[model samples]
Target: MKDLTYRLPQRRELTTALPGPKSRELSARREAAVTAAVSPGLPGWVVDADGGVLLDADGNSFIDFASGIAVTSVGASNAKVAEAVAEAASHFTHTSFMVSPYESYVAVAEKLNEITPGDHAKKSVLLNSGAEAVENAVKIARSYTGKNAVLVFDNSYHGRTNLTMAMTAKNKPYKTGFGPLASEVYRAPMSYPLRDGLSGAEAAARSIRAIEQQVGAENLACLVIEPIQGEGGFIEPAAGFLPALSQWCTENNVVFVADEIQAGLCRTGSWFACDQEGVVPDLVTTAKGIAGGMPLSAVTGRSEIMDAPVVGGLGGTYGGNPVACAAAIAAISEMEEHDLAARALEIEAIIREVFEPLNGQDTVAEIRGRGAMVALELVDAEGHPNAALTAKVAAECKAQGILLLTCGMDGNVIRLLPPLVISEELLRDGLNVLVKSINANS
Candidate 1:
């Protein structure tokens, strides 16, 4: 494995207070220029980022508990990725894959085809974002199966596109006011081991029963799922649940599409989170961490299913842009040479190590996640979701120079998505802040 040579300082340092004068001025300007709909989770504006730290306009360097919403697995600006991007940009930025082909695009496709789950001859369609990849996956699935229904899970988070928004389980913020969503999108139960008392088999049976009764297996084109639901608070579908669902999809000819957008590309202890369970998805959509924050996504699957779409059925103007493809090539190379999957496991171990002491705390209902994508679900004394405490804890951590993010429909989950490249020292320091924050908030 290649040794890390992090350029940024390893420790959190604050030259100014939380949102300092410069960041506050920028925020004020941003309010006037940017859309109100675009929520800035952090009050400060970022000027630079490297390794596991984000340097804001305020000169406050924060330990990045959230890796740009899990997009920068190899670190926000890996030297290798930046160098590749610069070289690619110098040659040609974009001719559009449809207008003119490039080797970098083809190389990225080849890498994705080789790495993604499943051994069957796989074909990939590249896009600019997770939403686009998902949209294309649906198109491919429907084309292959000649079916209209697409099944997504409750508490699942897909994307913001029209079809993907309908696929998403949350109604507010993401789905609200987005009227007349795409049709034939069905919501099914997910396996949340903490919330539901059912075993993996039982959860699978429950979901299957719902799918069979509501959206019949014959009518379904595909079952799009996150092996680990990201916005649903990093919920890992119970063991055996995914395999059973995959088996069911196989038996019924349903295209089981695993949305590994936030969980893939070595962010979750494995190349893909589906690898943990050996769940070979017929169609797997990937993005986010795929290009080390270069805005590249792909839908790779069995060749037969992927080929169902006619010529020109799936091509995007900016999809697989040479620059992004170059970044992807570099990012994948870094992941391989650095053994990022193992790094993700090590990150998870560090997080769990810090969390073990707080295991019995009532406010800390559950501490879960695989690899660097971990979360703490906070609940009140009555065992109800405690959004208040969650907010407080995050605020306290941020004040102390740790950047943590909250998720879940109820907004009670504090998710930690430190870059897989985070050092043991920075990770432990972030965890220390997290622990202190949670204790004070509790």
Candidate 2:
């Protein structure tokens, strides 16, 4: 694999307007051919991507502030990642790690064990997506404790599967009309300090009280939570809430599972966001940013908990494809070599500096996040969330050659997840575009 130096390729425009004629033609065709639910976030269609720029089918160059929804931590079209992927593709594609094991698969698992938090004897199992890892974590927990109930927090997004849909909190896009969800899934309130106006301890106490009174701690198998809620608007738990919950879970038999699918892999300036709290969870599920954009997920946990499941219970045909595993190995090496954790902190600093003036503005309700996983919530003078303003700002940013995304239950927050490997100049350029867009829209 080639070495990935800090390089920013020059940006050029070959077309006068975005979606120039060709992209618009193709997009129209796609609108007619593809399902309505399959929607692209950005307005234009992408034909090619390299460095920090995405070339739309119309020949426009747009800076990618959204790194494939935080999946491509190493930047798009990274030479090292591409070369590693090509080499693995040439050797073999799929051997099914379960039926026939391979070195790359085991190597990825070993790397996950070493990198994820907790000093206890750790084990890992690979899967295809974050939801699968989360589902398997619950399965392992149930098998280990012989309990039927699983606990999750409000505004959390686990996955799209039936069980995960039940675990998720939002309804419009994820759960609407998808009734009769998996049973034994319980929901609890999370620590949203900004809106709830509760300290971490207070929020934790409320959640615990609800769980103890309703779910019965003795029947619970696991308490799954995102160290920092991703799809829910980058809300970080109150400082003491996670530690207190960890202690409670320890006292009780419930396993503490950290769903770091979006916040892990140095995206939040740490290998695992849970590490920030100094509390070790029983299991950690990681996927996004794990393989430099490859489709790979893992469930790492204490050996005893992982081993509780019987043989033949936890294997998937395409769980650990060789190419994805190889990419994982390369991605992990790149993260360490570049000190992306520190770079994430640098990205956070830039965002804070850019959005500092907006803090006192009436339209800007809150600016919160850790490391590069940052967000800005929009509101009216009365502090009511303004999803329309958030949408308008994002659309303006996209038009100005910057791609951004909005999240949260109300769609009132603009979330930024630039690749950890992005250059300081490019990162600031994107943020400048965002600032200009916000100012113009506001």
Candidate 3:
């Protein structure tokens, strides 16, 4: 297969209005053909993307702060990842791992086992998406422990699959009308330091108390948590919170699963966010940044637990696609070679330098997150969520050829998921646009 020849200039430029004529035409076609429920964070159609810039159909270049929702940490079109994918494709696309397993799948598994937290013997099951990994993790936990209760936190977004949708906390978009949802999933409170005003220990105690009273360890299968909650806002739990929960799980024989689908893979200035606290979970679900934008996810865990599932029970037809495996190997290598974890720290410094000062202002309630995965929460005069202002500011950024993404249950968060490989100049430029957009809108 021939590749598209496009070299992106490392800057943001817009010659036409927000969406050019071609993009408008394409949007019209998309409207007719695509499902109505499929929503886009950014309206324009991107023709080419490299590093941190997205080249849209209208000749407008955007500084991409949203790295395909944190999928392209190595960058939108990483040289090493692309080359690996191409080489793998040249060999053969798929002989299905469940049918005729290849070496790439095993290689990727070995790497995940090595890089992820804990030096203990670990095994991994590769899959197509984060949700699939989550489901499989739950299944493994249930199978090993012979329990059914699965606990999650508020503001968590697991996925759209039936089981994941039920695990998710949001009601309007993700869970509404999607009922007949899966059973045995429960929601617990999270450590929202801004809203709850509780210390990490206090938050942990509250959550644990509730779990003890409501679900209890005897019947609970697993507790799935994000080291840094993503869709619910990049709320980093209090310092002692994770350790406390982990200890409780250990004492109770309940599986502690870290759902690092959004915060893992050096995106949070560490190989895994759980490493920040030195908290090792029994099972970890990972995806977004794993394959440099290729659809790949893995449920990596202790060998004893992963081996609990029956031989035929765990395999899937598309579970460990060779091409995606190749991309993952290259992506992980790029992260290691470039020290993207340190780069993420640098990016955090730059972002905090700018947003930290605005905290006292009425419009900017708080800044949360670490590394390239950061966010700003907007508030109104009464300190309530200002979703309108958030929309206005994000729209202004889009108009100026800067791609941004908004999240949070209230729809009042402006998040930055810039690729770790983004140049300092382009990142700063995007931040400048963000500051200008905020100031203008505020």
Per-prediction CA RMSD (Å): 1.2, 2.1, 3.0
In the range 269-357, model 3's lDDT, one tens digit per residue, is 99999999999999999999999999999999999999998888897888889999999999999899888998899999988886655
Candidates 1 and 3 compared by lDDT, better number: 1
Clashing pairs in 2: none
Worst 10 residues of 1 by lDDT: 1-10
Sorting all predicted structures by lDDT, with the top scorer first, yields 1, 3, 2
| Residue 18, candidate 1: C-alpha displacement in angstroms | 2.2
Give the runs in model 3 whose Cα sits over 4 Å from its true position.
1-7
lDDT of 2 by residue, 161-185 (tens): 9999999999989999999999999
Off by over 4 Å in 2: 1-14
lDDT of 2 at 420: 81
Model 1 lDDT per residue over 327-438, tens place: 9999999999989999888888878988887899989889988988899999999999999999998888888888999999899999999888888888899898889888
Worst 10-residue lDDT window, candidate 2: 1-10
C-alpha RMSD of candidate 2 = 2.1
Task: Report how far residue 408 has shifted in candidate 1, in Å.
Answer: 0.9
State TM-scores per candidate.
0.98, 0.97, 0.97
lDDT of every model, 2 decimals: 0.91, 0.88, 0.90
